[model samples]
Target: MRITNGAGLPAINEAPGAQIAEGPAIVPRSASAVRPAGDATTLRLSHAEMQKLPDVDSERVADIKAALLDGTIVFDASSLAARIARYHGGPQ
Candidate 1:
């Protein structure tokens, strides 16, 4: 049955109870799926690539750890927000 709308467009919503027969169900590969040996290749980042990460001063790290131990440490949300904003091109 051809169903048309006010604008003479094919009314897709009119065929509500229509059932279209489909092919066999495709079973997806689970976590235990057998993968090819060479397909699981991972590229190891070099020392230089890892070294490009942000540098943290050892003294500041120790100070933060000390503060955490003494219950005087408070996380600065703005710092993380700024970092995330910088990551997403909001600000640097």
Candidate 2:
């Protein structure tokens, strides 16, 4: 049987108790079978690639920790308000 929508497009029509046919069962590949040796597609990170990451500034972190302990850290309210406004697409 055929069915048509309000836009006059043909749609599928199935009986109330009709069952859909199942497709092929998916089988997962074994761990070693997933990747073979000397595969060009495989990615490897070298020592230089690891060194490219930005190093944490321990001195600045210690200063921030000291300010937090002494309650000397100051936050800009106007800058935070502008950022919130921009995120919500409201007035600048």
In model 1, state the lDDT of residue 29.
81
lDDT of 2 by residue, 6-67 (tens): 98654567567776567656767889777576454334445557678669978889999899
lDDT by residue (tens digit), candidate 1, 1-92 = 34567987757655678754566567678976886655544323455576887787888899889998898987789999999999999968
Residue 16, candidate 1: Cα error in Å is 59
Off by over 4 Å in 2: 1-54, 76-78, 87-89
RMSD, model 2, all Cα superposed?
11.8
Against the hidden reference, what TM-scores do the models get? 0.24, 0.28
- Once fitted onto the true fold, the runs of candidate 1 whose alpha carbons sit more than 4 angstroms away are 1-73
Q: State residue 21's C-alpha deviation in candidate 1, in Å.
A: 48
How close is each model in CA RMSD to the real structure?
13.5, 11.8
Candidate 1 lowest-lDDT run of ten:
37-46
